[model samples]
Target: MSEEDVVQYLQNTPGFFERNPALLEELTIPHPVHGGAISLLERQVSLLRKSTAEYRGEFERLVSIARENEAIMKKSRRLILKCLSGDSLDDFAGVVEEVMREDFAVNYMSMVLFTEQPLDTSVRMASWESAEPIIKEMLAQSGCYCGVLSVAESEFLFQSQSDSVMSSAIMPLVSFEGGQVVYHGVLALGSNRLNHFDKEKGSLFLDYLSDLLSALLLRLLP
Candidate 1:
């Protein structure tokens, strides 16, 4: 029979290999490497070994992610406790900036709240008229924006450090009251590393950070 006929027959008869077990050992195929003939059984063993290695690599990646998340949880707890312990609202922004810069290794950080009434705090207070357009364009509909920033956006948020920033994670701080969403402000972290804040990275951590800030601001604001 032809080679195609042989292949078809082998496919049709699942028990053919079991019936003639010696064929599996005798059947020789070109080796993937070394350019030599090897038995079908040897080829099967090689494929299984490759698959096992791949599975092991995937398992290690998952374990690394779990460990990273655990570390983040610990740091977040410390931040919460320290903030709550502080006596005045004035220290909130300073605490956040210090922790994020010292522990998290962020290159730059800034917070801006859109309020007509000036507040005595480190956080920048501005009118909604100017910040509205920038906030809308930067964040769009997403709660967090992680990637490179436009020139205007970079200057608006980072100012003097704008030229040094390569990537950023920007979060819109919002509060829900009586089923309506209130856009309070923006929290941003910039890094010199090009891939520090990637677009593909998960934003769940940023979302939690924004929620914490919003809740605290709601309590501290008049």
Candidate 2:
């Protein structure tokens, strides 16, 4: 009989193995690892071992992610508290950069405010008319963007540190004025690692930060 016929027969007659139980121990299969033969029982054990190892690895990975998210939430809470306690926009800007560097290990960061009026803050200020078109395009596409940025885009956001940044995340700070949406500013974060802010990565945390910054800016704006 053909191999298919034999397989069909074995599947159809499950009691065949029980009737001739010796085959469970005597039948040999090719070893997956070393070049040798193993009994059917040994092959089954090997497969079970592999499956168990995979499940264990997946469990550990999930635990690691949970711990990482917990730490991030704690850091985010601290950042919010600091912002709330700030007396001025400059203080807010300084604390944000400090926390990003000290707590998040960010390589480079930029906070840009869109306004024509002179501001005392250390963060860059530009008129909405002079804002880069790419920034507008990015805001149009989504509230947050995470991925590798072009050299020109990096320069506009990161300035002198542009060359060092391999990947970045951008969040637009938006506010409402006279019932109309206003794109007030942007927060850009850069990392040296190529995949630190990969396109596929989730941006929920960044979006939360953006919302906080937008509220702060709206309150502090002159």
Candidate 3:
């Protein structure tokens, strides 16, 4: 029977009145059968109420987790800002390493600042050898602002890296002053699992990291 018809049947069934003595006395119609069907209908209603309660509980837990995560990110961003205020590049690197471990749970992370002249063609930037072209392309494309990129799964750049490394998140750090975009750097992260970074995941923390790095670079730049 259709669900609506079944509901109508359950509500009006004579057997329900017979099974439930309390209900039978209240009803005007006389019920021939004692309480069997009424008992089953009461059980169904109880189960529905229980299932709804469980779903609501789960939703509340999810919201709590999201808020906790947000608080963690805010603390991490504050630490990054403190790092940016340092006078030396070495101090910044140390802070970046610490932040990556605490915030992203990633083992390998690097911050590479670009120069007008190529440093060395042999040394791959941020440990990704084949990504030289990709990096060059991105710098050319974006002109001079902070941007985010996800590496392709099949890309050889990631596959050839250490076995512990599975994925990377690349964000360009840009310094803008008086409507002029001056310095650019890259923040790279390496994780052991392919699913570590993806579009589905929120990148709010990463955006904050990029801003902090950009501010540091602007201060350090000549």
Candidate 4:
């Protein structure tokens, strides 16, 4: 193939010698010297085409992955908007669970809200007895709130003692008006899989969640 033909072919290929001008120079070498009679132009063209095809495949695969990630992110953002507009706490909780399940692929979920200072010694928030210790510890530690994602070992230990949760993320809700504290509560989340609530995974979503819960708590106070 002629040098001009080779250059045009390379340019037409999706990912050919776009990076190197030197390759074009070698192909355009006007006079052939030495023993090799035929110009190695056709050989270079074949290699370039093969490399271009592989790169095009890789680029396409990356594009597919990016598109999938974008769709998931959009769905997650929509779920957050839905949570913000929910009419009631029950509605909010439902949306929260749905978002976790559908967007984060979380398998288990729960929430706990703190009560007034006199404390609602009357009842427990979760039906699971195993959670009582964690709740008690949180209360005693002056921890406004906490969320935990149990490691595989912790999950086994928890289950051995009682029904255990795999992963969790907790946040505290403190309600105040005119500098007077009205209520404090913890919001909890759980997932049945490992590393589901890692810091890097859902930090933005969790921050939004904390803000939503804090606003709701503030509204609940007199």
In candidate 3, which residue ranges exceed 4 Å CA deviation? 1-44, 117-132, 136-163, 177-183
Best by TM-score: 1
Q: Please tell me which model should have the higher TM-score, number 1 or number 3.
A: 1
Per-residue lDDT over 1-222 for candidate 1, one digit per residue giving the tens place of the 0 to 100 score: 899999999899999999999989989999998989999999999999999999999999999999999999888887887777775567777788888998788999988888888777767877878887766777675678899998889989888999999999998878878997778788889999999999788788988988887777677777
| Model 3, span 153-213: residue lDDT tens | 2232334444556656766677777997543557667776767776467566666666767
Highest-scoring model, lDDT:
2
Q: Extract clashing residue pairs from model 3.
A: 16-38, 18-33, 18-34, 18-35, 19-34, 19-35, 19-36, 20-35
Model 4 per-residue lDDT tens digits across residues 104-218: 6765555554443332232224322444454444434332333453353234223342245645666555555798543355555656554666654545555555666677645
Which regions of candidate 4 are displaced past 4 Å?
A: 1-65, 102-104, 117-164, 169-187, 199-205, 212-222
Q: What is residue 58's positional error in candidate 4, in angstroms?
A: 5.6
Worst 10 residues of 4 by lDDT: 119-128
lDDT of 2 by residue, 1-222 (tens): 899999999999989989998879999988987969999999999999999999999999999999999999999889988988888889888888999999999989999899878887777888888776756666666668899887777888888999999999998889878997788888899999999997687888898888887887777777
lDDT to native, each model: 0.85, 0.87, 0.60, 0.56
lDDT of 2: 0.87
Q: Best to worst by TM-score, what's the order?
A: 1, 2, 3, 4
TM-scores for candidates 1 onward, in order: 0.88, 0.83, 0.59, 0.45
lDDT, candidate 2, at 19: 96
Ranking by lDDT: 2, 1, 3, 4
Stretches of model 1 off by over 4 angstroms after superposition: 1-13
